[model samples]
Target: MDPSDEGSSGKRSDGQIPVPAPVMEKKKKMMKTKMVRFTQAQINNCIAYKEEEMPDYDSMPSIIEILSDDLANCPQDYIDELKTIDDSREEDKTFWIKMQNEIRDEREWILRQCFTKGYAEYEVDIDDDDDEDNKVPARVAAPPGRRRFRNGVAVKKNLSLSGGGSVRKI
Candidate 1:
């Protein structure tokens, strides 16, 4: 048989038989790394959506959605804890900026991952808090009330020293 035709015979005369193409599988689809800005409502919906059903990714999926499912897979409070996170905390930490301290929590750490993957963005911008943040008014400090007097300099109006006395001045 012709040397070229020998290959067609399905026999290896050279003692070197290559594996069949059927055994080799196609490459897996890599998760989309593109960081898209999602509104806070959408993100919250995503969190809630995952509770009942899996999120269906389109032909392309954002990192947030994919990571949300991945991180949400475990028992965690990504949403409730996210609310308490201060804006400055997210703003100050970024890939571009070198950090003196480690990340604070899982949520922020996960969001900032976009930067390490080459997406330059902030956690706040990604959340798109244009409306969600506005709904809740900014926290204001309460008026300072009476001061504590360890030295007893300020006298009390109705201070009771002994149990028998109805009222006593300190």
Candidate 2:
């Protein structure tokens, strides 16, 4: 009888340590996305439509610039508003949020004449490996999702992609 095998209760008897078998991990749920490669003609058509029919927005004013101008002209605009209601009351926690909502409202108004009404399903990424300047991007960035006060507590809200907001909703 092998001395290594003596007094064994189905345990390893070879005097060598047994390494545990690797555990099969549960398959993780990955984001489901289908890549649709547009033909050169399709790409050209899109570019052509924007170039031909769409009014040029190259010199269009941005919200950042607009707001900056507004605040710059009157640095105490926010403070002034706060003062009129209650400046002495601790602090206005929802002031910034109210400003954010105003911005959202303005964005929605500006985008009322959008090409598409709702969100887009497909997100395109340019796979070009070139490290050059002025490279073209296919499609990207859904930035919507704002903090809205619900019972004075901030809650998430969704905005449409047409309003330059996110595709996901809350």
Candidate 3:
């Protein structure tokens, strides 16, 4: 009898084999949730739009009135912020106009960045001759008595070819 199989097999009177303890797996660490916030540029864009559409005048429209028609899809927080700004500086046309221009500049800068990045990343396949200036290629008809399918039945190419120069129906 082999010494290695001494305890492994039930040959011995005791009939016992030592079993190794199972290793415990380490638990994965949970990742923290990231906070979502709008960029300064996006905020500025909203403010600028408000100023351009509704200028200062006697009995001018209220902040909510000005933004009502425009901000149908905008977030509640954004609309609230605009209203707060307007209420805080009531009848201060100069301050509002200055703020509007600053916001407008920032918004424009963000738009320019988006356009620049998009244009830079865009690529054209110059080597590919498949599509020439978006024009569709003319379809070529099959030769006489050379139908793609045999006996009106579809089959893969390179398998077999119909010998007769006439189409047959089963």
Candidate 4:
């Protein structure tokens, strides 16, 4: 029997070695959690359909821009639909509350999916093995050229590619 094996008398009892503590442990949940409250900045970021906000989905800036522009030139029927939605909000407080809740969900989703800072700055990552063929080139400094943001999709850039030699750029 090894002398060090004993706690005091150098006699082993269980014949098992002691296990060390883990390097990393799971984090504990926060007790005093702050709830997310809606603000004007957040409301401004909302992606609304027509004048009313689009609840429960991503409200992309492009989507909002398209809706606004379309409303400006949209037919009376389309405008009526928008007004109906607004009227529903005015008539039913519960409906408005539901919409507001949906918008909150959308806001959270947007913050999760898109940039937390509101705007995303896309930049290519450079690796050690970068070369002429495999090089991570910088984005084009020139303007995107004639590609206006229409209805959240690129209007100038053709996305359809169906032919012998298919070519589509967005």
Best by lDDT: 3
Cα lDDT of model 3 by residue, 31-110, tens digit = 44443444666545544565455454547666788768889989999999988876765557667777878977866665
Residues 1-170 of candidate 1: C-alpha lDDT, one tens digit per residue: 44555565555666565434457676554443444555566444433432222223233343444567565665456754543453334344453233322322433454455346533333332334434545877688866985564553544354466634233335
Stretches of candidate 4 off by over 4 Å are 1-91, 115-170
What tens-digit string does per-residue lDDT give for candidate 4 at 1-170? 44445454433457555444458976543343333444546545554433464453222233334578678777878777766665564446666678778867766665654446554223343433334347667888867676554454432444567524333445
Off by over 4 Å in 3: 1-52, 58-91, 119-170
Q: Worst ten-residue run, lDDT, model 4?
A: 56-65
Give the per-residue Cα lDDT of candidate 1 at 10.
57
lDDT of each: 0.45, 0.47, 0.59, 0.53
lDDT of 2 by residue, 2-22 (tens): 545444444564665554566
TM-scores, each model vs. reference = 0.16, 0.16, 0.23, 0.18
- Candidates sorted on lDDT, descending: 3, 4, 2, 1
Candidate 2: stretches off by over 4 Å = 1-14, 34-42, 45-170
Give candidate 1 regions above 4 Å deviation. 14-26, 34-170
Query: Model 3 — which ten-residue stretch has the worst lDDT?
Result: 118-127
RMSD of each: 29.1, 27.8, 18.6, 24.0
